[model samples]
Structures are given as C-alpha cells and as structure tokens.
Target: MNDADLVDNLTALESLLQVTFHDRTLLRRAITHHSCCPDTAVHDSYDTLEFLGDAIISAHVVEYIYRTHPDASEGEMTAVKSEVVSRRVLAQVGQQLGLFPFICVDIANLRTFNERSRDSLCADVLEAIVGAIHIDQGTEVAREFVTRTVFPMIELVSTHAIDTNPKGRLQKVVLQRTGHLPRYRVLEQSGRHNDRVFLVGVFEQEQLIATGKASSIKEAGRLAAREALQLLQKKDKRSSADDTTA
Candidate 1:
C-alpha cells in the first residue's frame, strides 16, 4: 500500500485504538502480514515487530496486574496474566479494533484468506500494533494503550466464561471424573510453509471421540478435546436419564 493509504488506515486504527503512534511507519509495519510480502527484502512485515511486541505486552500486563491487585497472591496474578495474554483474548481485541480489514495480504491468495483461520493473523497484528506503539512513542504510552484498550475488553469478558483452554480443562475434567486423561494424536497435516493446516483427533482410552482442524496443531488439538468433552458430557447426561428411568 502507498503512504497515503497507510496514513488513512492508521488514522482509522488510531480512532479504534484511542491512541496514535508518533511514527506512523511503525504502525504500517505492524499491519503488514508476512503473506502480503513473502520477500522480506522487498517489503517490511510484522514478524520482527511481533517478536518484540510480545515481550513488551507480556511485561506490561504482568506489571499492571501486580500493581492493580496488590493483595492478590502470585497464583491469582499468574491466572490473570494467562487469561490476558491468551491467543483467544488477543484475537477478540483485534476483532474489536477492526484490524482484519486492514491486514496486508496477498491478493492472489484471497481464497486462502476465506478458508483459513484468522486468529493467528489477528493475534499477530495485535502484538505488532503494541510493538509499533512502543517504538513510535514509548513504553508508558504503549502501557496506557494496553490498559485503556486491551485490558478493558478482556475484563468485560465474563470471568465464568467457558474455559478457552479446552485441552487443559478437558484433561482435568477427565481425570477428576474417570481417572483417565485425554490424548491427542495428529490425524493429518497439509499445505505448504507459512500456511499449513493440521487435523487432530482427541481420544480417551483408545476410543476416537472427536476431531478438529486448524492452522496449528495445538489449536486443532484443543478444538478436538473441546468436542470430545462436549460429547462425553452428553453421554453422561443420557446415562443419568437411563438410570432414572430404570
């Protein structure tokens, strides 16, 4: 995209984020997905910025949580941090900011855009934005951005929200109820570098219960586990009803 277009998009993002980067170039870099320009030598992408931003975001969240909840124990702070930094949380934040429309992607591969998952892109863009803000302005400004924009959205999400960490939750629930843990096995993997998709199956005691597909193996596994848990819950309810009838 040209400078004018970049400026306009950044302006829109600023309105959405409620903060403006002093160096608009940083903001431009943040939104430039790798798929938009595979040749790094030709055009900038968000990967490097994402790496830096990830650290900055993590540190800021930890500091904020530590200070805000002084009386809360370390475990509580850890849980809050986990919730805040989760991929699911970041994707939600990105969606709220309408970042998807502004993503720099390959025009030729538009079909892939529709078919593939958007969560990774959204999370990457969110981190890249944080890195851009930190570089364009300063850590304090970036921290403020996190506090005002990101934190509020995360907080508004219900605490009793269904556990997004389905794999862990499923394992715990299974162990508690049946004294057995769920297992995940990769069923298939496809696509080329930077756009691969994984299919995973979740099993309990050699019984294949659920399967899912995603861009990443972990994501696919989690989804499969979630489906398996749901199926198991339904089975349990049916068993209870049969017992009552008898």
Candidate 2:
C-alpha cells in the first residue's frame, strides 16, 4: 500500500485497538505480509515481530492463568495457558477485529489464500501487532491489550475444558475399562503437501472404535480419540444396563 492508504488503515486500526502508535512504521510492519507490496520495504514483514509477540503472549497468558486460578494444578494452568495463547484463539481474535483488510500484501497471494493459510496469517498479524504495541507504547499498554483481548478466553476454557488433551483423556478411559491403551493408525491421506488431509482411526484392543478426518495427523488423531471416547461411553452405558437386567 502507498503511504496515504497505509495511513488510513493505521488510523482506522488505531480506533479499533484504542491505542495510537508513536512509530507508525512499527504498525505498518506488523500488518505487512511478506508478499510483495510496492510501498513496503522488501525486508519489512511481521516475522520478527511475530516471534517477539509469541513470547510475550505466552508469558502473559501464563501469568494470567497463574494469578486467576490459585487452586488450579500446574498441569491445569499449563493447559489453560496453551489454549489461550494458541494460534486458533489468536486468529479468532484477529477475525473479530476485522484485521485482514488492513494487512498489506500482494493481491494475487491474498486472492489465492485458503482458510488455513488465512487463519495463520491472521494469527501472525495479531501477535505482530502486540509486539509493535510493546515497542511503540510500553509493556504496560501491551499487557492491557492482551488482557482485554486474550484473557477473556480463560472463562471459555474453564467452562468447556477444551484444553484437555483428547488423546490422554481417551487413554485413561481405555485403560480403566480394558487395561489397554488406545491406539491410533493413519487410515488414509489425501491432498497436496501444503494442504494435506488425514484420516485416522482409534483402535481399542485391535478393534477400530472410531475415526476422524482433519488437516493434520495430530488433529486427526485427537478427533479420532474424541470419537472413540464417545463410543466407549455408549458401550459402557449399554453394559451397565445389561448387568442391571441380569
């Protein structure tokens, strides 16, 4: 984007973020995708800022969880912090803020971007902005921004327990019921390397209980584990009813 357009975007973003930048260039770099932009410097991108922001976000999230959940176990606090600082959650915040429009990038690349790629970019941009805020303003202001945007997720995490590791949960269930651990196997894979999809199956004692499909093997495994847990729960209910009838 040209200087005029960049200024307009920055002004609008400032209104959204509720913080004005003393160094406009910092904000510009935060929103600049590595894709070609005539007015942006070749080296100007969110890469470095995103690295710094990742660390800042993790630290703040850890601190927030530690303070708010005094009685929470260390494992629980770590899980909560992981979910809060996750790329998925950060991308959600960026999408809510309507941040994509302000990002300077090659139009061609933007047009071809897929959902996963777009989300990754949004997450990176969110962190980059935090980094820029830290540099241009100060740690206190940046912390305030994180508190407003990311800390709210703590309640959601607590309510849903979405941070619980699905594989671990399933393994515990399986071990208790059958004295064996659940196993995951890659059933199939498709799509190109950059946009691959995986199908995974969870087995209990050599029996395929459930399957899941996702963009990554790890996610696919989690999905399969969740399905297997539900299947096991249903079976347990049936067995309990049969025993009662007996």
Best model per TM-score:
2
Summarize candidate 2's per-residue lDDT along 1-246 as a digit string, tens digits.
677877888999999999999988899889988775545445588888998999998999888777555435577677777887888999988888888888776768565778877788889999999999999999999999999987888768743552356687677667876899888999999999899999999998899989999999999998898777666655765776788799
Candidate 1 lDDT, tens digit per residue, 1-246?
A: 687877788799888877876777777778887767777713489898888888988898887666544433576567878878888888877877778988786757655644135776888889988888888888888888887757775444313232466676677666776688888899999999999999999887787889989999988987897687667656765776788799
User: How far off is residue 70 in model 1, in Å?
Assistant: 3.0
For each candidate in the order shown, give its overall lDDT on alpha carbons: 0.76, 0.82
Query: What overall lDDT, based on C-alpha atoms, would model 1 receive against the true structure?
Result: 0.76
TM-score of each: 0.58, 0.62
The TM-score obtained by model 2 is: 0.62
Residue 34 lDDT in model 1? 72
Quantify how close model 1 is to the true structure by its C-alpha RMSD in Å: 15.6
